[model samples]
Target: METILFFIIVGIISTIFGKSKRTQGQSPKKPIKVSGMEDIRTLFKELKNEVSLPAAPIKSEQKVEVLQKSNRTLEQEYNQVRKESESSRKALAASRLQREKMKEQTIEVSKDECEPSISMEPNAQTLVNGIIWAEILGEPRSKKPYFPKRG
Candidate 1:
């Protein structure tokens, strides 16, 4: 708003001076002098300085090439990470299979160990018969009761 006011004031002053100068019979080729000459000059100088200053710098080709290289490296890293995860998954599956096989072997060994022996010893029957006969006879009448051992 202030810049617009300055331009309007300068324009009004220049027009009034221009009309007065025309009445003086002065040469029309000469530049018209106004009371606000210094302000206008300063405004033009500031505008020239702003125009001379560079705007945003343009991106060079080298910067774009560097970004492309970094993108490729990132892609390689992503593929490596994927491969590592897949290998670890396979290793876990193999270990699980091995654990299951170990469990099956352990179960088989335990079953074998738990089975009772089927072979009989010759004295097992004789010992059983003697215990039965002795219980039937009650207490022996004599201290030395003879009992024959049979094969």
Candidate 2:
């Protein structure tokens, strides 16, 4: 409301000055409005251009090339997978053959272990036979007693 009152006072002062100037034989020039400016049209044109600017375009060619590269890498990976699978098959076959050979020699290992091949030197009967005598005398120490040869 105060702004409107201030504009009203300024308008009345301008009217009074116009009348006084007219009485002195001088016609007052009209105050120019915004229509007189040359740059106003260009200002509107710049605003319209800014509003019409296009959005940035999304590119897909680089992404497509990356996908193709990944496909080639997957192909190489599958080749390596196949080679490792063949190696594992060969190792498994060799292990099965080795297991069969060990099974066949188990009988010989048991025979050798059951009867150890002792030497029959002259010291064997005296030294080892005295141990047999000591074991026969120590029979009562065990749950089941043992006796030496009667002969």
User: What's the TM-score of every candidate structure?
Assistant: 0.41, 0.34
Task: Write one digit per residue (lDDT tens) for candidate 1, span 1-151.
Answer: 9999999999999999989988899777878778579889999999998888756654788679989999999999999999999999999999999999999999999999999655566487877976999887877656555874566
lDDT of 2 by residue, 1-151 (tens): 9999999999999999979888896446655556756578878888898778745543698668889999999999999999999999999999999999998799778887999556776486778987988998875765664785477
- Model 1 worst lDDT window (10 residues): 141-150
Q: Which number leads on TM-score?
A: 1
Q: Candidate 2 overall Cα lDDT vs. reference? A: 0.83
Badly placed stretches (over 4 Å) of model 1 are: 1-60, 122-151
